[model samples]
Target: MHDRFDFLKNISPHHGEVLRNVLSKETRETLAAKLDVMPNGQTWYADIYQKAIYGPMVFRDPELNIIKTIEKLLPNYRILSDLYLEKTPDDQGFPFHTDFDSIGFMEHPEDMLTVWIPLTPVEEAGSGQLSIVMEEGAVRLSLIREANQLHSLVRVVDSSVPAHPPFQITQQEYDYLERTKVTPSLDAGDALLFCNAFFHKSEDVHNGKRSAYIMRLVRKDAKFNKTRLLALKKLGQNLAVVDELLKQHYPDAL
Candidate 1:
């Protein structure tokens, strides 16, 4: 993994207080209630499924103050997006993958970063633990066809007309994942930041509910094509308003 973890740690300050306030008992109860009604918001892939709730952008929410704090810590960068809450159970985990495929326009994938903050304490034995592999190792593995390429390769495979590579996880693949995966512990407010290119996954929730929020950030000079963005906006699915919002803030983010 190139020891890039230090860079991520350097950019983000200790925001345990802010995280605690945002995930306070009342907040968790309210969000949990929302989850009860919006189970469909959960995202499922292979071995893992998670309830994802978005927004309350850094511009409006107090918890988002972390953005500014991070900016100060890494003054050369700017946050590209808001946060996403992921709730998982002992039964929910994902195949190893990168987050780049889910977001659009990856012309320069390495420029992006994701900060995963656990809302509860996590341990190796815990159901929803984060797993990450070395970036260098993942890059080498990508060159070997038989290696498990859950994120990028999976997306390409899924996009094929007949979807050539089926989505099933092989036992060998699971064993490889188990061998490489590392469960990093985090208190309710601590966050782990890593490059988007990193191969990572989560363990199934076995005991307590695993709730986390992921925030995507990018450098200020990152290129975001406004025209293409508007074109996608015209398609007008769930992200139509997001296009309008981006245009308002970045005028050039189209």
Candidate 2:
């Protein structure tokens, strides 16, 4: 399944660290070591990028743990999708964009977040590590909401197809993102959680491959849940994507 928790046992024991009991350090080390030795398989999630595999729900405890973590941070939240994995080659990197806009249609971008956990130790920026814009890019996000055109940001990356040319913001918006972009050094087991609407990109890998898992968290009782649901249906999201999303989120309903 390539999900983060799938290879928890592979992580090193002494390196063990848990963030709010949601992520384990040993699991991170194990996953990294595993990626280092395992032969690369067929590309997964080609539609989103070259290497990715959007598999079935692999871990339920992680989702519950995430729920507990979010509740500690802020209450009344639920997950929007299952644990998803992505593998990027040395050459593939993404352009500046927000997961909120790309996946959730920016319906309530501020209320959502994307948790990125790299299985392998990512080198400095431009070495297949994440580059995040440091400024308060949420100002632009506010404008999208005020204009009631939030949907414009959705579908930027089709979950069903490889995202060719990667999605980038408009030239005007690029100026802000470029000014604040910072690629921080991240070790295995370190989890990067950011606003879904935060401007971020990836550096091309010069070292080896990069493996990571991402999970989306949304408010269960968010004000715009209905609106988001309508947009997802209208977009004709792939059945597998939609089904897994619902399964992790509304397990009893399924």
Candidate 3:
């Protein structure tokens, strides 16, 4: 019954304003301007979800500063990935999913955290906002026991490829999620934090653009399971890179 979603209103309201202003001022030359290339196929903004480039104004010092700031906000966690720039129109959104298909062992899915920072407005039940099911942190611990029983099977299952067979919720599962779901109203600068295991998806953007920057971070106290990493490597995904990236971004975590 405990809700895992934590919404922080205006975590960086001024920073958000500064980002918009800076991007607007340098629109002509900055990659941020490439948003106009909507019909094109090459620019990052053309994609519904683009990974922020490191050299652009929105990404350069600004992103680094945000990373550092987030590090402060989450004192004991390690940054797991770079900023994912999500720019979706009123009609597009993602399906409900977790950070990954499986954690592969007795790891709690809540061990990881994903923070979403909106640059555009997001209203409850409005298009382009996020909808999340309120799941308690304990459910993941319970699921880990189920995962334990399936551990050996994962070692040899050819289909255990990291993303090959997507793990989507069944109708019954979704019904429960829908019953527990809540969509928080968020304006630019607000941050929504949630556990990796929570069932969530973006709402259909109905009015304007829903732009946000999302990234993942892991608890510093968590350790990577070697067996799981090996299982993923068999599937052609080098999960060791996740650890390496974490170390590179937050040396203190190591």
TM-score of each: 0.63, 0.61, 0.60
Worst ten in a row by lDDT for model 3: 9-18
- Which portions of model 2 show Cα errors greater than 4 Å? 1-22, 29-45, 61-76, 83-91, 105-107, 141-149, 152-172, 238-254
lDDT of candidate 3 over 123-236, digit per residue (tens): 555547776655543234324433443454364444553432423456876666666666777666667776555557777765555666565666777666544544544554
> Candidates' lDDT values, in order?
0.51, 0.50, 0.49
Per-residue lDDT over 67-172 for candidate 2, one digit per residue giving the tens place of the 0 to 100 score: 5654665455565554334435534556775554335533445666556667667747544677664343533543353233344423322345333343345787
Considering TM-score, which of the candidate structures 1 and 3 is the better prediction for this target?
1
What is the full ranking by lDDT, best candidate first?
1, 2, 3
Alpha-carbon RMSD, each predicted model: 6.8, 10.4, 8.2
Instruction: Please give the lDDT score for candidate 1.
Output: 0.51
lDDT of 3: 0.49
Which structure is stronger by TM-score: 2 or 3? 2
Question: Lowest-scoring 10 consecutive residues by lDDT in candidate 2?
Answer: 8-17
